[model samples]
Structure formats: C-alpha cells, structure tokens
Target: MIRLDRDGPVWTLTLDRPDKANALTREMLVQIRDAAAEAEQAGLAALILTGTGKVFSSGADIDAARAGLATDGVWEEVSSRIARLPFLTVAALNGTLAGGAFGMALACDLRLAVPGASFFYPVMRLGFLPQPSDPARLAALIGPSRARMLLMAGQKIDAETALAWGLVDRIVPREALVEEARALAEAPVAAPEHIRRTIKRMIRG
Candidate 1:
C-alpha cells in the first residue's frame, strides 16, 4: 500500500493504492506507520507523503473505516504512530486532498502543494466525529474560523488560498513538487538526537 524510496536524508512514501484513489485501508495504515518509524530510526531528515496517481488521497476507505469503528480505536492507534514520528513529515499534495485525507496530510509538519491541489474534510457525510487531532491541527494551520469553514462546511480550498492562509508552507508546480520537497527537507534537518525527540514531543504536545 506504500512504496518507500530513500534518497540520502529524505524518505519518500508513495501511497500505492491508486486503483482506489489511495483510499487507506487498515493494513495500509499499518504499513505507513511502520515506514515512518523506520525513517526515524534511519536518521532521515524528513519523510514525504504523496499518492501515485492524480489524487493524493480520497481519504480513509469508508468501507474500511466503517468496518473498524466498532472494533474500537483502530485509526487513532495507527495514524498516531506516523503522526508522531521523529523526523518532519511533508505532505506533497498532488491533487485533491479530501475527507480523512486531510488528517494524513495534517499529520505532516509542513506541506508543499501543486497548483490544482485542494483540501477538504467532509466528516458530516459519514456521520462521524473528527478525530480529536483534526480541529487542533486545522486551527493551528489556518486559524479557527477558516478551519471551521473547511471542516464543518466541507469546503474545499484551492492551493493558492491555502498558501495565503498558511495551511501549506509553499506551492510549487506539480512537475517540481518532489524535487522541491526533497531540497527543502535537506536544509531543515537538525542533529538527529535533538530533531528526533523534539519533533516527537512537539506533535504529542
């Protein structure tokens, strides 16, 4: 469900579920978390998350999420592992990032998006609550009002406005995102021990 490629200090994680628009399944979530743990142990400077096809992620597999909800605490347990990794997580949004898809990208410390990219969270349609982390991360990124608009109204914001709103750190041409993220990752690294623990603590805090 994920393909990991290491290039020096960067670890790129490609969502390998393109056939389903990268809809995340339970097993896929576990694989992603494991890769993040590995990246931290390997002293990688950062991790990049993206999808293989035009879509970044349509969100968690609704069918999967439905099946797991009654089982108690599945998504939280796994996504938290990836979210709290030692190295920085970068979501290289290739296209529309929607539904719980925002949660995965939100887990990232920074985001680099392409021109046509957009973000949305449509939890109401599924009759579920936002994982406690969503609102916090969204508010922190784009402020309370905008976060409310996006998360509650299920509004989708374009990449340019997302940059201006600070939801994304930067915007690049779609053709240049991977190279740009890798270059950005190279410069922001901290001493391994310091960066690793610091990022983990920050996310958890």
Candidate 2:
C-alpha cells in the first residue's frame, strides 16, 4: 500500500507495508503510480518517495511474481513517471534498498539515505537480469564500474560507500531522514517549474 501526504508544496509518498519489509505488490505499484500521477497533476513543487519502518522496499512481491503478474511494464511506467515529473523528486531510503526497489530510487532526481541503510543488487544471485533501463541508470549515477560491481558481482554497499560512489547524495541520521528529505525537496521550489523541468529534460537528453 501507499500513503500520500501533502505539506505546502511537497507531496510525499510512503510505502506502508512494513510488516513485509514494504515488499512491493502489483496493486501497490499501481497505487504508487496513480499517486504520482495525481501529484504531478496537482502541480506540486516536489515529490518524496520513502517507506515506513526499517526497509525502503524488499522489491517485487514474490507471491505476485509467482502469480505471473508482469512487473517490468509497471516498473518502467512508475519509474518513468517519477523521472519525468516537472518538479523535483527525492528518494529517502530510510532503510535497506534491494532488488527492483533500487530502480525506484535510481529514478528519483536526488537520493538520501539513513546512515545505517544499505543498497544491494541481487540480480545475479536471483537468477534474473535487471530491467533494461536499470543498468544504464545505475551507471549514470555511480559510473559503469560500480554498477558492474553491483549487477555482476551482487555487491551490497553501505550508506557511506554508496555516498562515496555518488549513488546517494547524502546520508542522514535515521531520525533526521524525513526532515532532511523535506529540506532537499524545498530547494527548487523558488525556481520556475518550466525552467526546472526543461533543464531536467535537457540534462537527461
């Protein structure tokens, strides 16, 4: 499930399935995509993606995956929507980030993580390849070598290492994650929305 909250110009989307480590399900993904679309339509200044409890997300739901639900399309759609939002987007990784959930964080314009949080890519260990766009996006953030270390070697990187690799912009204390994310989200609010969106597009291109 997802929780959407608005405070002034910032819209926050929190993954609420803490009992399962916030493991993503098809229905949850749909809700997240819809909430993001709604936030964009409302012309919010920024969007924050985070999770409840100690894990950002455990990745796609195994039950859903076993049921043959197609996740690639949903992942692509949701990530693309967040990536192309006219306003700033931040991923506050309050805890562990693994599997497909990494793609969600990578899609965000900025990333913040709790000092104890960690990032892992388990595609090799899981006997599956990452989504096509994932490799390039990961490479873009932390460079090809580190991306290779993650994807090919199944390396798990701690917050400090991730920051050093340029994967996360900052590492905040667990208690300060939300406040820090809010501050980062507030940074571009004074800029013209069109200018920010255009520049984002140009940079991506």
Winner by TM-score: 2
Task: Show pairs that collide, candidate 2.
Answer: none
Among these predicted structures, which one has the highest lDDT?
2
Q: How big is the positional error of residue 78 in model 1, measured in Å on the Cα after superposition?
A: 3.9
State how far residue 127 of model 2 sits from its true place (Å): 1.6
Compared with the true structure, what per-residue lDDT tens digits does model 2 show for residues 1-205? 7899988779889999999999988888889888888988888788899999999998988888667543458877788778778888899998999988887798898999998898897889878778667899999988999999999999998999999999999999989888898887665787777876787778778
Which pairs clash in the backbone of model 1?
Answer: none
lDDT of 2: 0.86
Cα lDDT of model 1 by residue, 23-55, tens digit: 887787777777877877887778888888878
